[model samples]
Target: MAAALSLLLWAGAPAAAQRIVLPTGEYMDTTSLRNPGCGAPFYQYYQVKGKYPVASATLARQAQAFLQQRNGRYTGTGLITFRFGIDCEGKRLPWTKVLQTDAAYRPTHFAPALVEALYAYLQTLTDWRRASGPNREPANYLTLLSFRIQDGKVVAVTP
Candidate 1:
């Protein structure tokens, strides 16, 4: 009788396993998962709370100010997109990538300057609240920044 009860209890116990749901709607054991060639975790931004280092309105205002200060000018309307990761300390990760630009103006040299200006402005954003995950641990945040410029002036900034 003791042996039978022990066997029953053991069989009824929950398994100590973890499963993660993939983006393709497939469930996979956490242990069976492998990192892709990207050298980064699969869910890099999953646990992040506040994605942007600064508030949207503040970013927009700063972008405008930066453009005005540098006398940045453009001939036609264009868009610039930037991507980067913010670590748990609210500092930008060493990985900054300039995705692409939709420049529709002459003097193509302005594009690179615009990118640099944006980069410089971003470097000033150090007062960020660290992102936390569901487990209450600090997590890295990935974010995209978009800038719209017309006639050499920044008209909008989106986070």
Candidate 2:
């Protein structure tokens, strides 16, 4: 859907850096994404700490509402997991990775339209809580969101 991709472009993902490698060996060109030159994304379950409560939990709630607002589109019983990073300056990078699986836990493809819609919504979140080093330096870390769908509806969102 060109329209969907066009909307994704406005989400600020530039075509130069934003790359989408579909299983069909095709990629979407997004030409204006803000390059979050913060740094490499690192994940350490034990190392990441919050001097404050992580606000990503709030984002999870918002995503649930988003699904409800567009109820008829996302159809299927499965799980969609997204892994991404929030840069040092609290900007989300474009290296988002999505994994989908059916209710039986087998790898599968959820509706592409649904995936794109949700991905677009994630790009709109501006309330990311930046993690900082003990000395108060901006830090880059990875985060995840898993949406559970059942009977063509998003039933749960997990962090």
Best by TM-score: 2
lDDT of 1 by residue, 53-101 (tens): 5667777778879767978664545765555555565554533444444
CA lDDT for candidate 1? 0.51
CA shift at 6, candidate 2, in angstroms? 24
**Can you write out model 2's per-residue Cα lDDT over 1-159, one digit (the tens) per residue?**
556444442124632334465663223344344445554445442356522243445655677677677664567999877666556766665555677889998878877777776777666666667777655666777776677878666666765
- What pairs collide in candidate 2? 12-33, 13-33, 14-30, 14-31, 14-32, 14-33, 15-30, 15-31
**C-alpha positional error of residue 154 in candidate 2 after TM-score superposition, expressed in Å:** 1.2
> Clashes in model 1: which pairs?
73-152, 74-152
TM-scores of the models, in the given order?
A: 0.60, 0.67
After superposition, the stretches of candidate 2 with alpha carbons farther than 4 Å from their true spots are 1-11, 14-41, 50-61, 134-136
List, in order, the clash count of every candidate structure.
2, 8
